[model samples]
Target: MVQSGNQNKRETDGGTSLESYTVRDPERFALNLARALEEAGKAAAAWSRPREAGEKPDTMAEPLADMVKTFSKLTEYWMSDPARALEAQTRLFSSYMGIWANSIRRMSGEPAEGEPVEPEAGDKRFQDPDWATHAFFDFLKQAYLVTSRWASDLVENAEGLDEQSRHKARFYVRQVSEALSPTNFIMTNPQLLRETFESDGENLVRGMRMLAEDIAAGKGELRLRQSDYSKFELGRNLATTPGKVVARSDLAEIIQYAPASQTVLRRPLLIVPPWINKFYVLDLNPERSFIRWAVEQGHTVFVVSWVNPDERHGNKGWDEYFREGIEFGLDTIAERTGERQVNVLGYCVGGTLLAASLALMAQETDDRIASATLLTTQVDFTHAGDLKVFADEEQVEAIDRAMKEKGYLEGSRMATAFNMLRARDLIWPYVVNNYLRGRDPLPFDLLYWNADSTRMAAANHSYYLRNCYLENNLAKGRATLCGKRLSLAEVKVPVYNLATIEDHIAPAKSVFTGSRLFGGPVEFVLAGSGHIAGVVNPPGLNKYQHWIGGALGESLEGWLETAQAAAGSWWPHWQAWIEKLDDTRVPARKLDRRKKMLGEAPGEYVRARV
Candidate 1:
């Protein structure tokens, strides 16, 4: 028990008792303290050796510098008028005073006055009982929340700032706020502090050792461990949908899965998975594998397993990828299966490339593709979420300069960018769990695939950023592809567009708007979760939900007003759509018939780690 008055007294730290801060095991702590120092030395060695060996990247982005400049704009707006600056200061100071008063009342066994500050529902940061029940922690939590929220609002409501500046300000604020959270520090975090006391600081010693190991693993960079990577291997356990590598190109390998059904659909399906990551996301395990499920559904599935690009593919642009990747897949499919026209499915960047390819095909009167399905793909990047913040001209130019020297962008750069999109969930938790808690992460297949990143070819990534993001060219029917103007409006293939309702990479509104670009009948469907879970959800799992409606309206909100909701995965609904288009059947095509078997499925390309 502690008294509220005289906070500076030795017996109390504000309202928390000084006596309560005692280590339960003093002898254990005394022994572990030396070990903790030794571990700290190891962590320092791990950091310095990479720089000494010149292994540290010279072109690593200076985000902090950019953040400083972005925040300065917000600083200017608030400081322009003395009265405005004073008002802002007053607002913050008032919130602090309220928190102090509330803390005193709480110590005296009284209710808080109207709850001046509280964490929003679903925010897991302040979930500890001490954060609410204890006076000091509760005050600290409320004070931090109020100040951070106020800071964010200042940026959001700032006038005389351009859209881009405003956006950068908001993003930077969030990054700063999250980084500065009290929970991140052992001193401020009750749980971490308690753990340290109980473990006699041995937790920190082990965490430091792991931190050193992770730094060493990343080769001078921090590769935050989200899962036990040792628990997974492609083709062995993860990408285990039995398949053969029927074809290989400079950019991709074509894998034809074994048909489970004796008779399969005549129209063979080719999946173009994003080259930014491995193809195993769709085929993580037998139960969650869409590839395995599709084979069970009597479809001859062939997937494009893209190469982990390097210096050799530096100059490979969008056209080359269109030619060497998709065209190569089409050629091999025709030769191996004797099917000219095929059904196609593309995920993420693969979907964007496929849509553009179909558009290019439309122009050349090439009708090889019968129908198309795009999974969480964006043709228009207007509402593409936080990713657009990094695609600005300045940042894109910096990426260009870096890529020019290195030949290709490092896989970790893209991985970091994607992680930033959901940092509260993806980044900090791992930081706390892996480093603070001194524990190996539990085995999770999706996270394992997420960590297994792939490099981006220079020219291809640049063109994509400029055309799709910097300019809304593809949606506007002005994007040039293969020495010809590309128009999504010209693409007449029946399209099935899937968008995750909670997608940060590709917002449903953006997908719904882009649907209007297609010349053919576009069936816009909304899945239940975010990008990965939304698309990879298998029907047999009996999880999540989906929405399919009569027709899309001018706006997403208008369409959702009338859209019908159905429980479970969207895969069966998509398969049903495929049947409605063309359901011809033929004997399952043997894999080793036409093209020589180059390798096994989940090819050697995916095995290349950066």
Candidate 2:
């Protein structure tokens, strides 16, 4: 062996020289290791720290306890029947035998089983070549997939379990299986193992350092950084569409975007985004910004920027948001543009609020909103997807009690729950990148927006969980707002409903079902992707397809069977629909110079960090 003066330049196995690894400084590595240890200690201490006087105790424990109890019932069903338990055990054991047989055949250089157990298509976790080529990794991958499948089937066929209980079981089972994946560990994952060898344990040091920092950033909870957050700032790289805050209230701020065209639609467009997150998602950037796109399309766009609620907003329920937020926007538009009949769009929870308020207003004979566009919104919560697992009576009650302590639920809690919805993509990838691989994530605008969460007011959140999720009062026409019982049947405005095919939060089925609740002519358009991507899809990018001209039948499957798939973004179709309703062009209105400006485009309400 010829040893060079530069020790890192030495050849690896088989005399093939691999490139020198990045972490060659032992002193630096040692220092980082010490720091990482210190941070980890701090993380543990933070977790153990007692709550101050009057501080809210984490409400998650009761829910977790309930989950365990539910699981026990499921277990009892299987355990009660020896034959059933044996059958389940045999199925898993049989799969293991097949995997073992395949391994033996591969070692003997014979053909392996043609139909071997494999990860489902597009399963990114087992994408590495070694997972396919190497015996050890292949076995591990197959074993994991098999076990996860077995557990899933057990829950699926579990007798006498209610839908909610079944839903919770499926969600938690997936979460547990995802958490226990072989790829997450350094020893099991070929890529991480190779990295470990090349770096000489330097990666571990750096990963631990990041681990400590993330825990601290989350204030004892692990706030997984999906992207390099330092690269972003509000109004700098993001939310840059030129505009001004024309209206402000306790609940929300109204931003009137600068008109991109000389002439704009006579009817102004009011966007009400979900208060759970900031409004900037619709206006993320120039390319993906719906506000900028709509402005360029000759429409005056006004968006409601909900204030990140605190204890002061604790009592602000659905009624208050309707009056102060949506009603306020309509009033502002009328005063500024003298256009009372405005086209309105609502996204997610904001959409639900818009529908409810429209019902209330229709009852009062208020014809302020002319047409409505709902984006991935749900008026019904019967099939509200995995999020329902968190909205049961016990959990909601617990959340309400905990929220009352501080008058609001913590923003991080909401962020965590949403992440849990797509844990494999949102949670584990960040874990592997930040903690296991010792690497910071790339700078992404959407992820940056996702991390920026908003607290829920106690009253508003309580009403939402109980009415929409628990009781499903909104869909049943029993949801009372102001002095009247709200019903979607009373609103006669033309509605444009957009649902994404792959939305986890608001399932396409759920969205389709909610469309039937509207009394007016509802044009249900199905977009190609998930919640955010489906809506923010720009026409220039031409990424996904949209399904139109399908009859809204009783079942989502029946509609999909007959739905016509059209290429490109659904924006153009929506624009055409709006034009059909009313396309009278008027000279674009400018912000009033005589009136006071609350702030700039993105507004101070959105800039609220906490």
Candidate with best lDDT: 2
lDDT of 1 at 439: 78
The weakest ten consecutive residues by lDDT in model 1 span 1-10
CA RMSD (A), model 1: 3.1
lDDT per residue (tens digit) for residues 504-537 in model 2? 9999999999999989999999999899999999
Best by TM-score: 1
Per-residue alpha-carbon lDDT of model 1 for 290-388, expressed as tens digits? 999999999999999898999999999889889988999999899988899999999998999999999999989999999999999999888887888
Clashing pairs in 2: none
Model 2 stretches with alpha carbons more than 4 Å out: 1-39, 50-56
Clashes of each: 0, 0
- RMSD per candidate (Å) reads 3.1, 3.5
Report lDDT (CA) for all predictions.
Answer: 0.87, 0.88
CA shift of 388, model 2, Å: 0.6
